[model samples]
Target: MSAVLELTGFVLTLGGWVVIGATLKNSYWKVSTVHGSVITSSSLYENLWHSCAEDSIGISNCRAFDTLLALPAYIQACRALMITSLILGMCGTLLTLLGLKCTQLGSNSENAKSKIAMLGGMVFILAGLSSMVAISWYAERITAQFFDSFYGGTKYELGYALYLGWAGSLLSILGGIFLTCSACKEKHRDYKYAATRQGKDARIYIKQSETVTSAKDYV
Candidate 1:
C-alpha cells in the first residue's frame, strides 16, 4: 500500500525530469537554429509576444507547425516515461516495505553489500521521480503557450520558454542519474543475497562431510 503511494510519487518525479531533459534538448536545438537565435533576442521578444492571439495562429506556418509536431511527440515521450518511472518507484517502495516488515529481517541472509545496493537503488528511484514531475509540469505549460501563440507576436514568451527548457536540463540530468542509481542498488542487493545464501549452504555441506568422515573412521 505504502509502496504504491511512494512509487506513484517517484514516477511523477522522474516524469518531471524527463520532461525537463526533453525541454532542454529542444531549447538547445532552437539556440543553434538560425531563426531560434533571432527570435530569442530581447527586441524581437518585445515585438513578437502576443502576436498570435490576434490572428488564426496559422496551421501552415512552418515555425508554428514545427512546434506542434515536435512538442506533441516530446509530450508523449514524457508521459510514457512518467508511467514507467512511477511503476518502478512502486516496486522500490514495496521492496523497502517488505524488507522492513519481515519478522526475521536480519536472519534472512541480507548481506551488507546487497543491502547497500538495494538502499541505493531506492534512493535513485526517488530522485529520478522527483525530477520527472517538476520538469514535466513546466514542459506542459510551455508547450501549451507555444501552440496558443497564433498571432505570431510572442518573441519574449517563446524565448523565455527556450531559456527555461535550457536551465531545467541540469535538473533533468541529475534526477535521471539518481533514479538509475536506485535501480542499481536493488540489483546489487539481489546479488549479495544470493552470495550469502550460497556461502551458508556451502558451510553446512562442509560440516556434514566432516561429520560423516569421523563416523566412518570410528567404525
Candidate 2:
C-alpha cells in the first residue's frame, strides 16, 4: 500500500512539473481586455518574457522584452520564482527516484531511503508553493488593475497560463503530501516490527533463565 502511494505521488509530482514547464513556455499569462476598447481589430497578450498582438485577421506578432531591469518588479520576481520552482522540482524528482523502494540506487537500508523520500517530498512542496505564490501574485495584480475605476491604463484579464500554473501547483502539493505520508507509514511499520521483535527476544531470554534456575534447584 505504501509503495502504491509512493508511486502515485511520484507520478503526480512529475506530471505537475511537466505542466509547470508548459505554463512557463505559454505566451498568454495576461490578455488585454476588450471591455472598454472601441477598436476590436487587435488583441494584446503577454507572458513573463514577451508580449504579443493578434489582429482580427488572425495574424499575430510578438516582441520579447528588451531589458530585464526595466520590467516591472512583479515580472522579475515571478521569473525568479518560476525558475526556482523548476530547479527544486528537478532536485526533488532525482531524490525521489533514488529513494523509491523499487530502485536500488540508494542505501539498502529502508530507513535511509525513507528519509530521502521524505526530503524529496518536502522539496516538492516548496517548489509547488513557490510557483503558487508567483502565479497568485501576478493574477492579483491583474485583477486589481482591472477593477480600479481611476486607472486609465489598458485593463487585462487573467489568462489560461495562470489557470495552468494553479493546476500544476495544486497537483505538486498533493503529490508531496502523499509521498510524505507514505514514507511516515513505512517508518512507523519498521518501528513496530522492531519493537515486536525486541519483546519476543526478551520473552525467550526470561523463559531460558527460569528453566536454568529450575534445573539447578532439582540438582
Q: What is the TM-score of each candidate against the true structure?
A: 0.38, 0.98
| lDDT of candidate 2 over 86-173, digit per residue (tens) | 9999999999998899999979889999999999999999999999999999999999999999998889999999999999998898
lDDT of 1 by residue, 1-219 (tens): 422333443444445445544543343222111234443222221111111212234232122333434454554455455445445544544444334323343335444333533453454445355435544554455556555647353322334544454344433334334434544555565778999999999999999999999999999
lDDT values, one for every candidate: 0.44, 0.94
Model 2 lDDT on a 0 to 1 scale = 0.94
Worst 10-residue lDDT window, candidate 1: 45-54
Residue pairs in candidate 2 whose N, alpha carbon or C atoms collide under 3 angstroms: none
Clashes of 1: 40
Off by over 4 Å in 1: 1-43, 46-158
